[model samples]
Target: MEITFKANKNINQEQLLKLYNDVEWYAYTNDMPQLQQALLQSLDVISAWDQEVLVGLIRVVGDGLTIVYVQDILVLNAYQNRGIASQLMEQMMTKYTHVRQKVLLTEEAPDVRHFYEKNDFESCDKGSLVAFAKFG
Candidate 1:
């Protein structure tokens, strides 16, 4: 399958909403686009399309000259294990290699950790490094 990659700021909102809904790790109740308007405005987003169908996407939220946090790296359920997410992450990391750090927060799961480790992430030591999270 041919995959087209681009930094498409004006991605189809409907497709994105559907894709977000399909994510296995999170549930949503509010309007995604409204919630994501700030992110869409500030983040560097890359999308993968195969023959006009969006297959995967990745977003980097950062200061552009400093640390970058990887967010919303999602691939459709039907497209899992196809290396699309890896390619997207490689692209994202390459884009921010000059930054102080490229970071991501994963759920507490071995498989998720393995996935991030494959992409060059290490488990953050809470004793040495303080981490923060915002929960509702």
Candidate 2:
């Protein structure tokens, strides 16, 4: 498939919900309006489209300087393992090259860790640092 990458593209709720569901992110799927608002408010968004179909996406929320948190990066199940996630990340890294802190919190899974490690992420627990998070 010929995939085109775009930044801050016009994304609708239907497409966003479907993509999230494809990746089995149940929390985001629970409330469509909240998810839509979050996507709209994100500081940076990069999405991959196979024509009109949004097959993957990466969302970031933070000021352009000092800290930029990578809130979400996902590829549709059928499109996973095809380097789509990497491309999304590559775009995010290049766009926020000036940002000091590039952070992301994800579920603890071996594959998840491996993926981030491939993108040059070091675990705070394994490094000279500590990290914390509070969920609602």
RMSD (CA, Å), each prediction: 2.2, 1.0
Best by TM-score: 2
* Poorest stretch of ten by lDDT in candidate 2: 6-15
Give the clashing pairs for model 2: none
What clash count goes with each model? 0, 0
**What is the TM-score of each predicted model, taking all chains together?**
0.86, 0.95
Superposed model 1: Cα runs more than 4 Å off: 24-29
Q: Which residues of candidate 2, in runs, are more than 4 Å off?
A: none
lDDT of 1: 0.78
In the range 6-111, model 1's lDDT, one tens digit per residue, is 9976777777776776775335315666636744674798989888888888887878787888867888878888899999999988888888877787678647
For residues 76-117, write the lDDT of model 2, one tens digit per residue: 989989999998999899988998899999889759988999
Task: Give me the displacement of residue 12 in model 2, in angstroms.
Answer: 1.8
How many residue-pair clashes does candidate 2 contain? Answer: 0
TM-score for candidate 1, please give it: 0.86
